[model samples]
Target: MTESALLVCPHCNAVNRVPSARLDEGPKCGKCHQLLFDGQPVELTATSFQKHIDKSDIPVMVDFWAPWCGPCKMMAPQFAQAAAQLEPKVRLAKVNTDTEQTLGEKFGIRSIPTLVLFRQGREIARQPGAMNTAEIVRWALSKISR
Candidate 1:
């Protein structure tokens, strides 16, 4: 059997050990049985953000954006494309600065469309602005080892 790695479920917040080979096989959470990767960015609330960043073993890329920001709207599709291509290896998330103001302030995000990359609960890199899918993937991959 292939070795399994610990993965924190985005749905039920359960820690599950899944075979590495099954990473792309639509693996479900052991406890809640929800599909692990839904191929979409996880919308993060203030409460869930801390838990997710601290518990997840994989690298997390969070897009800090607000509905009113035109740049953020334009960048949304690129972020989604990157998320879809980098599934099972990287976790993509989004935080609405308008709603989750506390998180935005805490992160010192003065600009919309800021991408923060976190690993092991600590932020490693941050970029403020819109980036194409290739640039997003390149930036993320540069920070993490494959």
Candidate 2:
């Protein structure tokens, strides 16, 4: 049998099929040939946010932040660290509330540092506030398998 997994291209919004066994090794996008997991949060717009949530087979954690939010800025480094540790297992994404207002409203995000977890296109959990690297990692790990 053929094993297939979903991967959302970070450079372009292309959904590519990746083999399950090759996920940890490193997977490249079929269209752009970019590494699927680059240890950075995927910058998501309104359109891409919806697409990624629906198309990604793995669990997604989205950081809802705004440019002017001080806490959001302070949490960036921690978020990046968590993303690096969780690579190839879970997808880390960021939604700028300043740009993606529609997506922010769609998720009922009232707080600037809200982190929403999505799996199979549905919201599984959400945490509101700026968390440290360990807290963020624990929260994300609680929702996904290693």
Q: Against the true structure, whose TM-score is highest?
A: 2
Q: Give TM per candidate.
A: 0.91, 0.95
- Which ten residues in a row are the worst by lDDT in model 1? 1-10
Candidate 1 lDDT over 82-104, as tens digits, reads 99988788899999999999999
Local error of candidate 2 at 35, Å? Answer: 0.2
Candidate 2, residue 42: lDDT:
94
lDDT of 1: 0.89
- RMSD in angstroms, all models? 2.2, 1.9
User: Clashes in model 2: which pairs?
Assistant: none
The RMSD (Cα, Å) of candidate 2 is 1.9
Relative to the true structure, candidate 2 reaches a TM of: 0.95
Candidate 1 pairs with clashing backbones: none
C-alpha positional error of residue 3 in candidate 1 after TM-score superposition, expressed in Å: 4.4
After superposing candidate 1 on the true structure, give the runs of residues whose Cα lies further than 4 Å from its correct spot: 1-3
